[model samples]
Target: MASIPTILTTIFLFFLRSTISQQIHSNPDCTGRWIHIRRLPSRFNLDLLTNCSQYPLFDDFCPYLPNHGLGQKTHAKSHSWFRTDPMMLELIFHRRMLEYPCLTPDPNSANAVYLPYYTGIDALRYLYGPDVNSSAEHGLELFDFVKEQDSPNIWARHKGHDHFLVMARPAWDFSQPLINDPPIWGTSFLELPEFYNLTVLTFEARAWPWQEQAVPYPTSFHPPNLSFLESWIHRVARSRRSTLMLFAGGGGVSATPNIRRSIRDECENDTKNGTNGGYVKLCDVVDCSNGICEHDPIRYMRPMMEASFCLQPPGDTPTRRSTFDSILAGCIPVFFEDLSAKTQYTWHLPEEEYGEFSVFIPKEEVVFKGLKILDVLMGIPRDRVMKMRERVLELMPRVIYRRHGSSVDFRSNKKDAFDIAIEGTLQRIKSRLQEVAVL
Candidate 1:
C-alpha cells in the first residue's frame, strides 16, 4: 500500500511527462508536422516547367532552376545568377514542402493544411493570354474546387481556419473591386467568404486584417548553405563603399507618384557640382528602363554593395523587391513613404524604431517641399550610419528565400526565410485553434 502523499507525487510526475511530450511534438523545431492538399491538379504546376517557354519572361525565369526543379548546385565558388519571377514562390513552396521533414503523409496528423494553388501564375496566364473572361472566372474554379472536397470534411472541420495560403504578390493584387469602381487587377479568390478565416502570406499586407501576414519579397540571391551566406557576409564587411546613395529603379504610376526623377536629377546635379568637401562620394544612378535591371543579378547587386544608402521610392505598388536586395547587400534603405516598409513587412522586420535599420524622409519633404535627397542622407552621422548598416546585415538572413531542395544540415542552426515562415505559420495556427476551443 502506498502512502497518500507518495501516490499524489507519482500521479503528478506522470501528468508532467505527458505534457512535456505533447509540447515537444508540437514544437516546430522538433515535429512541425503539416500536410499539403493533394486535390489540386498536377498539370497546373508540373506542366509549367515543360512549357515555360510559352509564358512571359521565360528567358529571365527559366535558367534559375537548371536541375529539373531540384535547384542548381552551389558547391562551386563561381557566382551563379538566379533571377526568378516573384510569383514563382508558389512553385518553390510546393517543391520544398515535398521534402520538408515536417510534412506529414497523413492529414489527420497535420497541424495545418497548405493549398498549393498557383493563383498568381494562373491569374497572370489568363490576364496576358487572349482569354479575358477566363481571368475573371479563375476564382470561381478555385472556390468550386474547395466546396466539392467535403468527403472527409477536413476543410469543414474548422471552416478552413486551419488552412494556409502563400502568395508572392502583394495583397492588393487579389482584392475585389467595389460595386461602383472598375476592376483594377487580380482575382476575386481572396474576397470569397470561404477564405475569411484562412491565413494568407503575401509580400505586402493590408493594415486592417489580422489574417494577412507580410513576408519578404524574394531576391535573386539564394545561397545554398551557411558557408555561402557567411562568405557573402565576410566579403561585404571588408568591401569599401565608394558611393553615398544609389537609385536603380524607374518612374512610378499615377496613383503612386514617386520622386524617382527628382532623386535622379539631384544625383546628376551633385556630380556636376562636386559638393560636400569630398566627404560624400558621387551618387550612382542606373536607368532601369534601358535593359534588364534586376534580371542580371551582378548589375543590380554591384551598385547596392558599393553604396551607403539605397534610395527606395514607391513603384507600381507600395513595396519594392529592391528593398530586400538592398538589405541583403548590407545597404541601408531610404524610404519615402511609411507604407513602403513601416506598415508592411511587420513580420520580418524588427518592432524597434524604423530608423534603426532604415532611413525615412516623407515624400512631401523631397518632392513638394524641395528638400535634397543627398543632403538628408548625408546629415545622418557616420557612427549612426555604421550602426544602421550593422542592423541591416543582422536582418539579411530573414529576408532571403533559400534555394529549393538545397542541402542544408538541420543541426547547423541555420534557418532561412522559408523556415521562419513555417515556424510563424504554425505558431499562428496553434493560437487560432486554442482561441476556437475556448470559445
Candidate 2:
C-alpha cells in the first residue's frame, strides 16, 4: 500500500491532468486569460500554514499568517494595516492568488496553470541550518512528483511552457549552483529540469531573460480598493517633503554587506538638513545603525513618506525590499545597480526605462571613482525632481496587493502587483508557445 504522502501526491496529479484535459471543453464565451490554479496536496501549502509557529525564521509566525499572510494586525490613526513580515510573501502570494481575477474553476478553460506551491516556506529548514547536501531535498521531492506524472496532456502539453509558479524569495535562493563543494546558501530548485520551462515570479529575478521575472515586494500599505489607492496617492502628492534625500538603512559601523559602502558612510551622520552657510546637505539619514529596524519596518516607511529620493544601495544582495517600500511611500528610488531595478522588473517599472521613475548612480562611481552622491542628486533640476516624484506617485498602484477578503467585494478595475504579474506570465507563456508552434 502507498504511504499517505505518495497517495495524496498521486491523487493531486490525477486531478491536475483531468482538470487540464477538460479545459478543451470550457466555455469559449469567457473572455480574458483564464488561470488554472493547481491544487497541490496540503503538504505543499496548507500544511505549512498549520505549522507556522515551527517555521525556522520566527518563534511564532502564526500572527503573520492571519489576514492571509499579511501578518499581525497593525495600523496608524484608524487605518487598516498589518505587521507584514518580509519572509511571509509565500503566504501572501498564495492568498492573493485566490483572489486573482479571471480564475477558472474549469481546468479545460485555463490558458495558463498557476502552481500554488509554497516553495519558499518549504525551503526554510534546508536553507537556514541544514547540511548543504540536504539543501535540495524539498525541491527535489516536488520535482520527482511532477516528473512521475503520466499525463501527456498536462506537463507535456507545450512542454510545461504554460505552467507558472510564484516564489516569494529572490531568484538566487532557488538557483544556488550545485557545486561539488556547495556553500551554505539556497536550494537547487531552479536547477531542476521540471521547473526550468515554467514562468516564475519573485521579488528579485535574475537579470537574464530565462524563466524568472521580478515582482514587487510587499509593503505596509495594502489598499482595500482603487478608492483607497487614489486617496493615498493624492495624500502623497500633497505631502511636504523636508529634505533633499533620504537613506533609512544601515551599513555604517561595518562595510561588508552593501556594495555602496562609501555611500552609507557618507549618509550615516549627515545632520545638515536644510542648509549650512549656503550649503545644502545631501540627506536626512535614519541610521538603523545596530539592526534597529528588523521588527520595525515602519522605521523605514514613515521617513520614506516624507522624503524625495530614497538611496537604495544593494544590501547583502543586489536588490532590497526597501526599494518597493519606497515606491509604496511615493518616494523616488535612487538605485546603485542597474540589475536592482532596471533589468529585473521589466514587466512593471519604468513603463519603458528606469528613468521614468528612478535615479541610477553607478556603483563604480561611488565605490571606485570617489563620486559624491550628494553632488549628483543636488545637481538635478528641481523640475526634474518634481516630475520624478509625480511618476513615482503614478506607479504606486502597480506595486501592491490591494484586494483583501473584504476588499474583493469593493469592485474596481485597478490591477495591483499580483494582477500585473499573472497577466505578464500568461502573455510570456503564450508568446513562447506561439514561437514553438511556428517551428
Q: For each candidate, what TM-score against the reference?
A: 0.83, 0.86
lDDT of 2 by residue, 128-227 (tens): 5344467755476665555564333656666778888878889888876666255557887887766778888888887674779888888766767666
Task: Please give the CA lDDT of all the candidate structures.
Answer: 0.69, 0.71
Top-lDDT candidate index: 2
The superposed Cα distance between candidate 2 and the true structure at residue 220, in angstroms, equals 1.1
Q: For residue 156, what is the lDDT in candidate 1?
A: 74
Question: Against the true structure, candidate 1 has what lDDT?
Answer: 0.69
Candidate 1 error regions (>4 Å): 1-39, 48-51, 55-80, 150-152, 178-184, 252-257, 271-280, 409-411
lDDT of 1 by residue, 278-312 (tens): 43466887667644675566776888888889999
lDDT of 2 at 382: 76
Error of 1 at 384 (Å): 1.1
Error of 1 at 31 (Å): 4.9
- Candidate 2 has its poorest 10 consecutive residues by lDDT at 1-10
Off by over 4 Å in 2: 1-32, 55-60, 76-79, 129-132, 147-152, 255-259, 268-272, 276-281, 289-291, 406-411
